[model samples]
Target: MTQPVHPPKPRPGDRVAVLSPSSGLPGLLPLPFELGLARLREDFGLVPVEYPTTRRMGSSPRERARDIHAAFADPGVTAVIASIGGDDQITVLPHLDRELIRANPKPFFGYSDNTALHCYLWNTGIVSYHGGSVMVELGRPGAMAPLTADSLRAALFTSGPYELRAADRFRVVDRDWADPATFEAEPETDPGDGWLWHGPERVVEGRSWGGNLSVLSWLLMADREISQDLSAYDGGVLLLETDEELPSAEEVFRILRAMGERGLLERFDALLMGRAKTWSFDRPGDHAERARYARDQREAVLRALAVYAPDVMAVFDVDLGHTDPQLIVPYGGLVRVDGPARRITVTY
Candidate 1:
């Protein structure tokens, strides 16, 4: 297979497509979506053009796919970003015009359920961004986190090597976007102790792969974009993370164990485990509980690695997933993980 090509970056004055290829939560919760859109213009100096289904709730898979096709096919739109992630993007995959998106390569940004799209773009030999959705990172309550803003700015507009920074403070819990007062101040954050490293000391450099762990599991079950030929991922850097659903430690292990059973774990020399989003609206745990959740999840991942990919280097909590001060990882783009120096740099 050919290496994935980084698509053209958007300029400050360019008009970008704001799409809801997933759940279209922007309709139900317009506050963050609007806030995010304002930032796209005021903060980033880019105009956001929304499609008919961009904010419509309960949009069909075919409809979402149509919007996606239109966004990629539109020459005036320099980039495509998700309004937010949803649950059933897997269904949208069958409807995507692979040839169209491949022919019109543009920067696409999203994560979580959007993982499905990232994998699709990866297979299409085009690099898409695995971060910076409209509602989450850009529409963050209060002011956008400085780290998130800086990282997203680089990912959206720049085309070069960008180093990932460990956020000193981060938030795992979420606030209700519907509540007006939620935007009064920045979401509360706890002190981040920093990333935890495991395995051998060495540098590993390769194109990045993987996304939201739960989403990847769903994709695996559906037998979608994941190559059955295990050799396809050889020497690639794995990017994995849990979502706000707060999956159990056992669940995390089972998914990795399943991947290992398929001979997928050993293909990668290094793993960049994203910071676990421990607390959620459904299960609002205290700081201690959240910390324990994070710890147990790490243990689960380590157990899987020890069993299948013992030689693989692992770094936990690099702030790339559901965590605050999110960093962007270019899906299928070059990633250098220096275990000895404790650094990670990605080509945007």
Candidate 2:
């Protein structure tokens, strides 16, 4: 098939679907969810239309699929954004009607478990986004990060080259969504060590591919959404980042090793690794521990690349994926990584 088609951008004042194609965490965690919806109205000037199962925890895959179908089929709806990402979005894939989604072709914004839908859309020849969930980015405590707000605005309403700048500060430590005070102020953050580059000095531009590393690994194992024709991804830019669960450095290596074994890793001309999320409420580490974790993950990625795609250009600590002040990546859209200039830009 030819390159994926770019969906039309959603204008301000348009109605956007806020559905839970993954977990209905909005129902369980009303604080962030409600705050997120308010921002869509006040800050972004978009009307958020919720679906039947959007807030219902434990909603079935078929039920979630119905919401997706309804969202895309509605002509008044200019875009669809996930309420949040969860573990079982992959199950909803089989229930999706590809023809229906392709026909409507609205921008779908999300990451993490939403990666499942992004891959499915890519296979259907539709360009989808890889970040900016309502609950996470929009509902960020204190206020939305300016970097995230700007990146998302460009992705949602404009079309053209938008250069991505490295975040000067990033937060890996998250506050408890269960607590009321979590919404009172912003989460703690650490100083960002700007991107680290590896490989030959050059520039490479290609369609963007890859997402939450663990989610992609699961998709590979299930044999869903991945192309059997290895050439389909040749010269593509691979975007990868770990989530809150924080998979071990060993696991990251193993996943890339498997992709390399399948000839997938060697196809990409460049790799953009999102800043590693080293701290979580479950395993809240101090400054030193966080630094160590991030460093180890980087080493693991370098180790895999050396064995697999040594010639591929790589940039680490990009502000995308699970990191605070997240940037929206246009899956299947053009991404330019300039190694010599130390710059990165994406075509919305």
How close is every model to the real structure, measured as TM-score?
Answer: 0.99, 0.99
**Whole-model lDDT values for every prediction:** 0.92, 0.93
Looking at model 2, report the run of 10 residues with the lowest lDDT sum.
185-194
Tens digits of per-residue lDDT for model 2, 11-114: 88999999999899999999999999999999999999999999999999999999999999999999999999999888999999999998999999999999
Residue ranges of candidate 1 with Cα displaced over 4 Å: none
Clashing pairs in 2: none
Across residues 78-184, which tens digit of lDDT does each residue of candidate 1 receive?
Answer: 99999899899999999988899999999989999999999999999999898999998999999999998999999998989999899999986688899989988
Q: Which residue pairs clash within candidate 1?
A: none
Flag regions of model 2 displaced more than 4 Å: none
For candidate 1, the 10 contiguous residues with the lowest summed lDDT are 227-236
Cα RMSD (angstroms) for every candidate in the order listed? 0.8, 0.8
Model 2's alpha-carbon lDDT is 0.93
